[model samples]
Target chain A: MRRLLRVSSFRAVLVYLGLFLASTGIVLLFLHGQINRALTSNNDKAVWRDAAMMNQSYALGGLSEVEKLVAQQSQLSGVGVYLLADGLGRYIAGNVPAFPAPADTQMQEEGWLHLRLQAPFAEARARLVRFDDNLVLLIGRDLSAQQATMADLARSFFIALLLLAVFGVIGGGLMGRQALARVENINQSLRAIISGDFSARIAPSSSQDELADLEAQINQMLARIESLMLAMREVTDNLAHDLRSPLTRLRARLEKLSLSAQKTGQADDIEQGLADIDQLLSLFTAVLNLSRMEAGTGDMQQQKIAVKPLADEVMELYQAVFEEAGWTLDYVVDKAATTAHIIGDRHLLAQALINLLENALVHGVGSPPHLTLSLTRRDQQIIIAVTDTGSGVDDHQLAHIRQRFVRLDESRSRPGNGLGLSLVDAICRRHGGQLHLSNHRPSGLRCEICLMVRE
Target chain B: MRLLLVEDDPMAADLLIDRLRCDGDIVAYAENGEAGLAQATQDAFDVLIVDRLMPKLDGLTMVRQLREQGADTPVLFLTALDSVDDRVAGFAAGGDDYLVKPFAYEELRARLEALMRRKQLAQDTMLTLADLTMDVIARRVTRGAQEITLQAREFSLLEYLLRHKGQVVTRSMLLENVWHYNFDTQTNVIDVHISRLRNKLDKEFSAPLLHTLRGRGFVLQSADKLGDL
Candidate 1:
């Protein structure tokens, strides 16, 4: 739950919902105040008009005329209340049965008084006017109905605001959840790609909304990255190939001189020169091949080949070399995956496997000389691993070994361009796979290439 | 062999031409594809070695034109572009062989010799190097009366060496022609396989048919030719 709230989408939704809640609350409060003010003003205006009329009636025909008008208006409900009282604080003939005690002697002193006309009557806003000969008139509208209606409106507004708040939070949370799911899908693919599966991509969602647009934009970015990676790789490969030409001509001239110098016995120095040139050339070629595979632009004929036979073929090719080097060659295939197949370029995969085996033969020939090649079927993957029972590489150096031109301290004297594992890593990536190097238990190094299998 | 060399680098061309001449072959030099096409058309050459990038006409277009004109002289592209796509493009333009530049002179000579010999050899089932004979149809090998048993890869390696019997077959050549690998490994894995194959072919024989030349490559020569060299 905390994780969901921490997601950026969820937090944005929360912020929007909070703003909505506050705005709606303010609007509801303002609306309630406006309605209350209008109702009170209308009540006050009716009271003022009744007061003027009562005073005019008193002027026209004295107390009897005022009393008659009050008596006539008092019979109607929700109209003005009329309380005609003598100076002794006793009620006369009017709708109010008794004079309110607070309005007894101070009738003329206060201009307006809010008082209950009777014990059961609603509150009223009345004007206290002194008539001739100390007679008092209390006239105002009953506020019960207006007050009830205002209360009802206030209740409905609060209910509506509450409901809106509840639904808004739910809708926003649901939206955030949906958006987070799609984003997480994209994140999963990007993570896979970061972990060396360059073929990975964001999975598209169902709706053609903004999230879909985002997915499209992100997928476009990945496509561009993939292409740029290829172009960079091509540049390096072209550079290597270009370098080879002049170097080749130089070596040719050197060989010619060396052949002529054979009479003076200076050919040995030239042979060393030629050897250095060959080393440079082999390194150049290795880099070119590695880049070509990484670019994924070579003529790779992908086909569905049974996994075991492919492993068998590579093992057959390397077994003789291992035996010649006095290393025991062992092979194993998981019985369950005997019929497993993978879609890949056969020769490239074979080369990758051979490179691993050759790496063992070159660097892993320690005290107990043993190299094991195994093929196992994993979930939607085929793992080809070569383990050498020797002094394994340090845990720190194991990761660096897969990078280009990264040779360990001990293997510096070995006859490698230091691109063996690098090329295998590139080939595995091209096949939509990964290469994992780990120090095996009891002094050995395990190099595993996990390749996606053909369904 | 009479060879036509089309190259833009003057020094490279001179060195290559001089080396080819020292190996007892007649050579003609063309600084560009235009001159190369003219020379190829004017004279009957055994092989045409053309550089890929040149002025006036590129190697591919020139080769395509030569092929269109019904000239069957084998053409080899000596280029700096070693990408698989580049090689495919070279062959698509009717090139018989493609060798990247900065090559061992021996390798270049061997490829040309192979190209020329490819035209001379008849389409026969049997391939013979003195007493050793291979039946291409049966995938069998026999030396005199003794039958030789071999693995599939070993058989292919032996077949390639026997096809270019007396030529200096470089390791890269064997890797490309036999194993179909375009890259080189620092380890001498190919040499190991070649040594094993040599053992099977010459272990019990009187005169070794397969011979390795230091600073060059392996050559399978008949007993009579061995003394001549």
Candidate 2:
């Protein structure tokens, strides 16, 4: 709940609503004060007007003025009857309860007014008029009904203000909730993005607000980063594959140069030295091949070929070599995937397999040497198993062996560039699968080509 | 042996041409792939060394064009770039071999010699060093008239070394030619086989034919002539 209010805009909305209610209360109070003043002024004006007319009637009458005034007041209820009191505070004719006389003396303060909360009799007043000695006039009126009406008006105003307050609160809460929901979505996306989901993207909002623009900018940044990462990987891999070929050639010539140099003949020594230079030249030759692969601008004729046919062709070609070496070579193919087609460049695949075969023959010679090639479908995946009962590689160290130019100590005794397994691994990854290495029975490494079965 | 060199880099071409001529192969230079292809097509050259990427026509295209025109000449690319795809592409385009540039003249001469030998199409087609003789076509080996039986890998390794006779064959070279390893991997396969080859070629012979240059490579030559080098 507190998290919702953490938003600056939400707090601003709360402050705005609070001030709105406070201002409404202030305005209502001002209006109430104005109504009170108007009511009091109207009552005072009515009393003054009635008194003036009453005085005129009394002044016009010769002897029955008191009786006439008494007859006028008889039609109005709550309008108290009154007549002039003698100068000694004696009421000649009035409805006011006569208070006990103060000491038989006339009231020194003549124009005195009195008000009280009585239902029928509310206000009274007396004033002295100097006429041929000393005369006095007294009047009274009830104001209870007027007070009750004013109280009723105040109650109704409060009820109306209460209704306004309720509506303001509900409307304000809904508006705040909607605004908060929009902000929360953006925050959630940012949090997810920071957690390392480069694939994550903010939902494009239709609202043409500053937040929407921000989301667009963030998405663009993520795209650039992803592409750059891909580009960097391409560069590194191409360097590993392309750079080492010439180095392989150069190293070959160098070894030969050192060989000829051992000859006692000076000509042979010079020729041998020149051979070292030959290796260097060869090293400089095929460097651009990696760049070409990375660019992917080469021939676009990738095709699917049966693994058994290709494997059979390579095996037959090398069959004599293996036979001459006095080693047993066995081959098999499952009926289901008899001629399972693997999609790729034929020569590249041949080369990839050639590496695996060479690794086996050279590394497989010491321990009950036997080379077996088989193809099968397992778990909806096309698996080509190449097992050899020979000097098996350690599974723990197999991962490093796949790295370019990283031949293991045991395998290095045999002739090879370390790129064999690297190429194999690259081909597998490109094909949307990977090479699985495992131990075979007795003493041998089994290379399982874990490839995607053609859908 | 006259060789046609097609390279765009004037300085590299001149230096290589001069060095190759010094090493005894007749040198002919072409500034661009087009000129080189023209020379290679018209002339009777023993070996054609090309730069893969060149103006007027790329090395691969030029080679492919030559092959299309019925020229079965050997081609070798000289470039700064080295990638399996590049080499494969060049080979697919009908190139016989590829060499990355910034190279030693010695390595250049060896490839050219190999190309020349291949061009000559030697009748015997044998791997031989001094009294040691191994016929690759017959898959037979005879050390001074005594037949020596060798494994397939051993025979292939010996063939590769014999192909570039009078040179130190590095582990990498044997790997590529014999084991077909294009990536430079530190593998004991080369060393183990070389050790075995030394045993086969020298253990019973009066003069050991295989000499291991410590920290360098193995050299197959007349044991009588092998000096401290």
Q: Which lDDT values do the candidates have, in the order given?
A: 0.82, 0.65
Best by the lDDT measure = 1
Q: What are the DockQ scores of the candidates, in order? A: 0.34, 0.06
For candidate 1, write residues B13-100 as lDDT tens digits.
Answer: 8888888898799999999988888889999999999999888999999999999999999999998887776888999999999987
Model 2 C-alpha lDDT per residue in residues A333-398, reported as the tens digit of each score: 888777567666666566667668878877777545788888887766778788988767777886
Q: Which sections of candidate 2 miss by over 4 Å?
A: A1-426, A435-449, A453-455, B14-26, B38-44, B64-73, B81-85, B102-105, B125-130, B135-138, B167-173, B211-219, B224-229
C-alpha lDDT (0 to 100) for residue A46 of candidate 2: 61
Expressed as tens digits, the lDDT of each residue in B199-218 for candidate 2 is 78778888877767654566
Writing each residue's lDDT as its tens digit, candidate 1 over A35-135 gives 98898788888877888898899889998998898888887765577889888757876788876666542332246666765644667767767785679
Q: Give the DockQ of candidate 2.
A: 0.06
Query: How much is A26 displaced in model 1, in angstroms?
Result: 20
